[model samples]
Target chain A: MNKYWHVVGVGIQNTLVYRVNFLFRACFALIPLMATIYLWRAIFASNADSPQIAGYSLATMTSYYLLATIVDALTAVAEDDWQIAADIKDGRISQFLLKPIDYLAYRLCLFGAGRIIYAAVAALPATLFIVVQRSHFLLPSDGLTLVLFLASTVLTALLQFLMSYTIALLAFWVLEVSTFIFILFAFEYIAGGHLFPLDILPSALANALSYTPFPYQLYFPVSIYLGRIAGDELWRGLLIQSFWVATLFGLARFAWHRGIRRYAAVGG
Target chain B: MNASSHSRAFAGWGLLRRYARLYGALWRNSVVREMGFKTNFVLWIFVEMLWFALQIAFIAVIYQHTDRIATWSKWQVVMLIGASHFIQQVFTAVFLLNCSNLSELVRTGRLDFLLLLPINTRFLVSFRQVDLGAFVNAASAVAVMIYAARQLDLEPGIVQVLAFLALCVAGVLIHYFLMFLLATICFWTVRAQGIVWGYYNLFTVARLPDGAFRPGVFKTVFTLALPMLLVSNVPVKLLVGMLESPLEIALLLGMACVCFVISEAGWRASVRQYTSAGS
Candidate 1:
């Protein structure tokens, strides 16, 4: 346990050295926030007299996007699986395999470290900036809802990591894993509700997505923060996310085993 | 001077053939690499299909609430989305796969070998690696565009089709230049991979209907300064007979030309700054 903590500490320290990279990442994360502001401003301008859409007021929607931006920043998994694949390809994994530490734990520690650094430097600042600039849109509401939002956000991150890791394991068989990564990224834009709220989805499609786990990874957490999902809906969403974590965990383990068995380190 | 000019033209043609051959070889190797894990390749196709379905589903949901987005009708928006994906695929196919590899080349000093070659180093490096897998996405997007057009019952005239094709080509050029400009920044900052990722986020705004943005400062910025909307919005509008103004077409062409020149100059500057991996 202490060893794991030590590893995590080291990981955090390592990430802090690359401060500029993290800042750039945070800046990039703001693109969605900017787009949403521009889009909602247009919508509000068009419907100046009518600010409400479905249950959300224009201010609520804007705040939702602002909160969603921070959620996205904190919850988004590491983007580079190519590095891991390269490690496996180049026999670097053999070094890890021989180490006393668990490879999975090390990778998780590294990711957590990066996320922790980002949360401190970028996500928090961006969230504060949004609140400061758009304080008028922020509705003072429930502490309970905020707690649920944080829980859902952490679970979403775990599920996202599991999904990505499962996909990355395909590098064992595939010479290049970039195409798979691209496809995953494209899916995240639509199903993960990064582009728009799932509430705005058509009934048939929303129903279909509800049966799947993609929304729980992003939409559920964002909805919680926005106070769009409450009480029974929040609990149900958490339960769904837990189930996804378990299922994806199983799949990730299976892939890792099968993949690692086939992985012939090509270079020293 | 005349004889030297003729030889240069002949050399240029020979270099083009060599690059073509290299591209063909890369394509074949990529196919074989993919075929080695046939199931994975098939799974990738399904994954892409899933994305297409989700995009259509999102559009459908939005259209159900409102008949129009900005000034774009449901069909027009759908066509635009498909066209943007088609244009995106062309960039993914031609340049994106190689951009990451170029960083690796610079890191490994393999770039020196390319520079020492008789061929144009820029051309060789740019086209050396191609993502043939993106062809599937391109084909699917084109099919979606054709179907969307038919569903809208829009019969494009010859001139419109020609303009659409021209705009698509220009879109590809603009995308290439924009990406190359970003990638060239890597020469200065060795680990500018985040810039590539950040640039894609910019495309998220671009993929949406340009009509959603009011004709103001923002519109001018997007249409001229950044020109993301010109990548697909203009092309789709022309095909749907919505863009009739000569000014709009000229603006798109002008933006493409500017991006091309800026990106070319940036590439040359980056090359000059490059001192090979160890140095």
Candidate 2:
């Protein structure tokens, strides 16, 4: 446990080294957010027939994107998957195998530390953007929603990390896994509600997406924040998210066990 | 023409021919390299195709509720998005990878080798690698454009198509110069990937309808300053017959020229600032 705490400390220092990178990334993301806000504003403006399209008023839709950005900032895997893939491909994981360390636990610590630094770095810009659009930004209506949203977001971060780690484990078999990563990312981008809220899709399509882990990765938490799912539905959604987390955890462990059997290190 | 001027013109033409042949060699080298990673190459094309399909799907979803978005019909908006994708893919095919790699070159001091080469350093650095995979996505974008044209019931003449292609070249040039300018920031910093990627994200603004932005600071900045709006909007407008004046086309061409000049100057300045990464 102390060793893992040391890993977290080291990870925090490593992440801080790229503080400038994080700052610029967080600042520049506002450009696309501006476009999305304007695009939605235009969409809502064009529809004179009703104040809501797919049950999203302009204000609520605006909040959706803002919250989505915040959620993404908190949970995005960024290049961790690629780094993991590289470690496997280049024989760096051999060190972990020989040492008394669990690679998955070590990576989870690094991810947690990275996210803590990243979300802190991004908070300023995100707050500024939200403040600038304060009229449209919505907070949770009640204390339970806030607590549940926080709980679900932690699950989301774990689920995202586990899924990415599992995919990166494919490096044990394939020479290149970037395309696979990107293909998954595209699905996650659209299905996870990064591009837009899944609720905007037809009910059948939206309902179908809810069963996928992609939605649980992002949309579920953001929706919880929006109070879109409530009472029985909220509890059921959290339960589903937990199930996916547990399932992916098992899958990740299984992949690591199998992959280690065939792993070979070339360099001393 | 005077004899000296004639000799000067001949020498310039000779330089252009040599550079063209050099570019051909670079493209060949990149093709060979890409072939070495065959699965990666094919999968990238498939990944990009999935992304482009999602863009169209998102448009379809939007149009399901509203008839028009800021004066753009469903098909017209599709055309606009397709045009943006077309420009982006072409730019990616030709120059995107090379520009993105500039930071790595600077970091490793591999740029020293390029600077020592006999050829023009900027040309060599900017056009050294092409991603043939992106051209496959470019073809998919053209397919969407054709489908959108069919839905709009428009029959564009040869001249219209040629003009659209010409403007797309201008659009690609604009993106190349903008990205090159951004990447040249690598000379001043250890790494400028974040900033370059930020500019790439900013290019998403090109896909939205120009009419969506109200005339104000946002409009002025993206139009005349960065010129994101002009990249695809002006070309698509001409193709869809929404072009109100010849001046819009003129503005786009003129902006392309301005961007080129600025990018060239910035690259030169950054090169002057470059101190090789030493042991």
Pick the TM-score winner. 2
Question: Which tens-of-lDDT digit does each residue in A1-268 have in candidate 2?
Answer: 9999999999999999998899999988888889989988888899877999988889888999998899888998987899999999888999998899999999999999999999999999999889889999988999999999999999999999999999999998888999889989999989998888898899999988887899998999999999898999999999999999999999999999999888886452
Write candidate 1's Cα lDDT for B177-199 as tens digits.
88878888888878877777677
Which portions of model 2 show Cα errors greater than 4 Å?
A: none
Q: Give the TM-score of candidate 1.
A: 0.86
lDDT of 2 at A255: 96
Instruction: Name the best candidate (by lDDT).
Output: 2
Candidate 1 stretches greater than 4 Å from native = A40-50, A79-100, A124-136, A166-189, A204-208, A243-268, B1-46, B215-218
lDDT of 1 by residue, A1-268 (tens): 7898998899889888878888887776675566666665655555566666656676777777776677777777764366676777677888876779877667777778878887888955585667666754675368887788888888988888788777777878877787788787777767788767877765687789888888887888878877778888779889989999999988988888887788787785
Alpha-carbon local distance difference test for all models: 0.78, 0.91
Clashing pairs in 1: none
Candidate 1: CAPRI quality band: acceptable
